[model samples]
Target: MHRRSAVTVAVAAALALLVATLTVLTGAYEITPGGVVSTLFGGGSGTDRFIVWEQRLPRAVAALLVGVALGGCGAVFQSVARNPLGSPDIVGFTTGAASGGLVMILVVGSAGSQSVLVGTVAGGALAAVTVVLFTLRRGLGGDRLVLSGIAVGAMLAALNDYLISRAPIEAAETAKAWQYGSLNAIGWRPVVPLAVSLALAVPVTLALARSLRALELGDDAAAGIGLGVTATRVTALAVGVFLAGAAIATAGPIGFLALAAPQLAGRLSRAPGIALGPSMAVGALLLAVADLLAQRLLSPFQIPVGLLTAAVGGAYLVWLLTRAPRREGARGAR
Candidate 1:
């Protein structure tokens, strides 16, 4: 990694730690930073330990991991599509996962987290297959993949709305809450699995980063250099799908982290192509900050973190769109 990129990762990691500390200390019981550190290392009071371990720490960890997962996957998606708008949120994987969870919640009425998880994973896999099937003949690159994903995502989104509308009011309420995507209900059960999944997937993503970069030189040039264009692209896509799927299953599809994290990371690092490590770090920081704000923004009320991300993400999308023409013009002038 470049010195600047490494520095970006370090700064993001430091900020994420600071925000997580704040999150652990911000509850009504009010523990000191020292208390939090002490509690983490098994030296604090029982109540302090309970609050930190049982409540706040899990939530904080969830935010960080989900951010990492989304950001890494977002970077992969953009690299594969060769477009900044190619995040999972745009491509439909998130909506598909949400649809699965909604199906379990509304139709099957499965209250168990395992059932919801299975539904989400299955839903996400289905969406990936749908998009790939559409673009298989043309291959997974450039505008084709992005367009197929958009179409799949839109149809799935409509299906989600229909499922919610047809369900009972109580079920509909539950589904709606899940759709908004909050880290509020997160605990060790979910966080542990998410962490494990990322632990496995992150290395695979980083391993593929070199090939993905070469792919930017176009399929013909990549093949000329002995790169297996189709296989590498598919593998990268699968890894991206897994990362996004795992995150959506764990966190209920938090909006725009997958969309914005990689873009922000690229700008911050100023490195060629998507930097997965920096993107993951940036993602972790972004979510930690968002969760902190969500908790403190309403004080005792404590709104969902998803709403905050969506509001910010919407603005980022607009900025990206307006900036694109200018970027293209600059390239033309050069």
Candidate 2:
């Protein structure tokens, strides 16, 4: 890696540490870093043990894993689609995942991990297919693909809201939380699948790193260089969709991290190509910080982490639109 990439990674690692420390030490049961360390190694009081092992530790790990997945997925999508706005949330994948989870919650009356996983995967796959079909005619230009995704996403959003409105009061309440995205009640059990997925996906993403680089060059250029444009795009999209769906399975539609992380990392690293590694690190950092804020900012009445992300992401989106240079092309209908 270049020195700049190395430095960016180091900075992100440091930030992750700081956020992790803060997250562990700032809760109602505030424990020292030393105490947290000792407890993990089996040398603390029962209360400390319970707080760290049973509660905070799992939550912290979940934040890290979720952040990494969202960051990686977001970076991949942005790179493949060649559009800053091409994220799971923008393209309907997150909404689809949320819709799937809601279906399980409302129709099946099941909220188990497996149910959530299945629903999210199904919904995300459906959205991915819709996006691919809509954009395929012109072979995935940035603006065309983004507009198609937006249309599909809006339709899914409307469907999700309608379903939520029709559900029973209790189901509505449950679906409401899923819509906003929360990490509450998550434990080690669900972490296993997340870890397994990450382990499976990261190496593949890294291996495709060079292909992604070639992809940054337009399709014709990429093909000239012996890269299978269609295959590369499909592989990247699959990885992104799977990661996003898994994330939704674990923690509803946590929006914006996927969109903002790569942009933030790009700004931070100032690298030639998209900063995938740094973005993943920054994404993990962002989610960790957001989760920390969600835990403490509202205190006893904890808000969903997605709400915090949405607030930050919405502001960032406004800034991007204002600052981004306008292009004269066939603009899609709003």
Candidate 3:
């Protein structure tokens, strides 16, 4: 890694840790920093232990893990598509995962976390298959892949709306809340699954990072260098799909963190290719801080972290779109 990239990753990690510590201290139960420390080390009273260890800590960890998962997925998608707008949020994978979870919530009437997770994975896999089929003829890079993903994502979004509309009133309400992407009900159950998914994904992503970089030079160039272009693209997509599914299963498809993390990491580090490690660190920081603000920003009402991310991400998208031409022009000039 470049020195600046390493420094960016380190700083983001530090900030994420600080924000997570603040999250642990900011809940209604109100443990002091000292109390949180003592409880973490097995010294505080029973109430302190339950509040700090059980309640607050789990939420913090969930935010961090989910952010890491989304961050890595975003880096992979953008690299594969060779487009800045190719993150899962725009590409339909996140929407597909959300649709699956909605199916379990509304159609099957089994809103249990595990059932929802299964649905998310199935839905995401289905979406990946659909995209692969769509792009099989034209291939997986440049405009074709991104356009196919956007079309699939749009259809899935509409399907999600239709399902919500047709559901019973109570179930509809529950489904609507889930659509907002919350970590409020998070526990160790979801966190463990997310961690395991990352453990499996991170190594594969790192191994393929070289191939993905070569791929950025175009498929012919990549293939010329002995990279299995088709195989690498397929593997990267699978990893990205699994990461998106696992994250949505854990936290209901928190928006825009995936879209913005890699772009921001790239700029902060000024790194030429995808800054996967820095992006994950930045993602961890962004989501942890967003969740913290979501909790404390409005006080007693408590906004959903997804809504917060959407609001911020929407603005970021607008800015990115406006500047894209200029950025592209600059790149062409160079």
- Give the winner by TM-score: 3
| RMSD in order of candidates | 1.8, 3.4, 1.8
TM-score, cand. 1: 0.94
TM-score ranking, best first: 3, 1, 2
Question: Relative to the unseen true structure, what is the C-alpha lDDT of residue 259 in candidate 1, on a scale of 0 to 100?
Answer: 90
Write candidate 3's Cα lDDT for 1-334 as tens digits: 7799899999999999999988997787766788788888999899999888777889999999899989989999999988989999998999999999999999998877678878998998899889879989988887787889999999999999999999999999989988899988577877887788889888887777778889988888888989899999999998888888889988898999999999999999998777888888999999999999998887767899999999999999999999989988999999
2 against 3, candidate with superior lDDT: 3
- State the local distance difference test value for candidate 3: 0.89
Model 1 lDDT per residue over 196-266, tens place? 88889999999998899899999999999999998998888788878887887777889998899998898
Clashes of each: 0, 0, 0
TM-score of each: 0.94, 0.93, 0.95
**lDDT of every model, 2 decimals:** 0.87, 0.86, 0.89
Candidate 3's TM-score reads: 0.95
Ranking by lDDT: 3, 1, 2
Judged by lDDT, which candidate is best?
3
lDDT of 2 by residue, 5-64 (tens): 668878997888789777776687767888888988999999999888887877888888
Which residue pairs show collisions in model 3? none
